[model samples]
Target: MIEQFFPELKRYAEDFVASYGYTAIFLISFTESIIQPIPPYPFIVSAPFFKLNVYMAGIVALLGNLLGALAAYYSASFLGETFVKRLLGEKLYLKGESLFNKYGFFAVLIGEPYKLVCWLSGIFKMPPLVFLIASFIARSIRIGAFVFFGNFLEKFIS
Candidate 1:
């Protein structure tokens, strides 16, 4: 579906990962967690194509995402709700706020649009340690699933 817009993205991601290795993975994942619109799955799946270790790629991606989430969290915390609402737009901010209000920590744990949840967590003053632990677990499971899926694809193709 994304290829309809970015026809060369897959190829570009493959080449980028091949050339830059884990650094490429980290940067891709980092920007994705913030506002890049592109998901890191393609770059992560390309790891095996470049003979990079998928597990390590997943770890690097997880770390990058965690850092990016933290950056967003802190930015929202420091910038205040009005600024965050402007940044995220009123509709999205309201939706995120509703989810945070209703689900609390579970919103961060289970929300699909994680960036919003991360920002809401900070804006709502979720405990830092709690946020960290939840994000770590959620991101690990998410990245681990992608890594294993990539491994499966690699083996299937081989």
Candidate 2:
């Protein structure tokens, strides 16, 4: 089912990244980390084909994602736990709490488990410096993976 959308998404990502370069990749990565539905994978993977330097693409993506994660963290902190409980429902919220409590730092280190961890970090009032460092490292590594993939693809195709 997800495969059907790939071609169109690929085309759009290629065009946008080609036209805007690092700015487009940064924006996509930033928004995706916050609430945007379009993952930045397409942009990262298509970056080489779009004539962007792979290293620059990864750096831009990492910075954007870190900033966006910071935004979400601050927003959640401002909103507080009561708001989240209401938003996610009692059961879901509790489950998230449990997962975050168990996973701790690893939650942010790995992206898939990060949404709840990001929210809980704020709700629980984790130290900002800690959040920033962990988030930056994890996001950098994640985007680096994409950059490597693009490099590999570019080499293979050439």
Candidate 3:
């Protein structure tokens, strides 16, 4: 688990959400989509604990992820494959490239290691419109599920 290696990161996320609310959600989600190792789920889950609106947090997170994905896409496009491969590492870059080659645009929908998919989409020159649409749909479903689970857990605990 991430905590085993980066305990401070977990506390920092919690503290960030507690201190900054929706802004924290957006930043956390955005960073996760781009490069942050920590996922946004736990931050979203902690929303209610901070008296934040879970549904609104989900929407904010979704928007942040969309923007971050776009940024990643564009970065890979302009920066070239070699730069991206180095940033993402050879193994991950190769794996993402493989998935994109195998699945085409649908790889964005697959959403495994989501950042890699975004980077690969750009590196491979996927149609921008298709990438955006697929990312929106996939991220909506993914964030919605996390919000639903977070809400359920909040209620269960309360």
Candidate 4:
């Protein structure tokens, strides 16, 4: 359904990323981790249009995102569930706690259900080394896919 919006979406993505360059990559990744509802796709897709190397763009996205994720995780862990309950209200925060308790690794995949799992892993206090490994896998998959499609994918598929 949303595929129909590609013309407008592509313009917005390309323009924003092109205008902001690498800084946009940092902001998108950073905000996605904590404050906002954005996913990392737009940043990744926009890289090619800006003449930025996709590999470096992906790495910038990863570093910024990881920092934001780790920060959010520590915030949640340090503040404790009680504070989260009070702030977000008991119902919503408890759902978050339950998600962490039950399907921890899988929950990592849901926030953006793609690359943005980095922040959730941090929020859940997944081990640093483990989180790093998980991030490597997730971000690698995203960057690989982004580059593949943006580069040779159309020819291969066609």
Q: Which candidate is the best by TM-score?
A: 3
Instruction: Assess the local accuracy of residue 105 in candidate 1 as a C-alpha lDDT between 0 and 100.
Output: 80
Superposed by TM-score, candidate 2 places the C-alpha of residue 129 at a distance from the truth, in angstroms, of 1.3
lDDT by residue (1-158, candidate 2, tens digit) is 32366667656766777889999888877776666556677677767778877778888888888787788788889998888787657997787677667876766676364555567677767688888888988877777788889889888877
Between candidates 1 and 3, the one scoring higher on lDDT is 3
- After best superposition, candidate 4 residue 123: deviation in angstroms? 6.0
Residue-level lDDT of model 3, residues 36-128, one tens digit each, is: 878777767667788987888899999999999999889889999899988989988887777888988789998578888888899999999
RMSD value for candidate 2: 2.7
Tens-digit lDDT track of model 4 for 39-76: 56655654565677666777788777777766666666
Each candidate: RMSD: 1.9, 2.7, 1.4, 4.6
lDDT score, candidate 4? 0.62
Instruction: Estimate candidate 1's alpha-carbon lDDT, on a 0 to 1 scale.
Output: 0.82
Give the clashing pairs for model 1.
Answer: none
Residue 122 in candidate 1, Cα distance off native in Å:
1.5
- What's each prediction's clash count? 0, 0, 0, 1
Using lDDT as the measure, the top candidate is 3
> Which stretches of model 4 miss by more than 4 angstroms?
1-16, 86-89, 109-125, 153-158
RMSD of 1: 1.9
Q: Rank the candidates by lDDT, best first.
A: 3, 1, 2, 4
Candidate 4's TM-score reads 0.68
Badly placed stretches (over 4 Å) of model 1 are 6-12
Candidate with better lDDT, 1 vs 4: 1
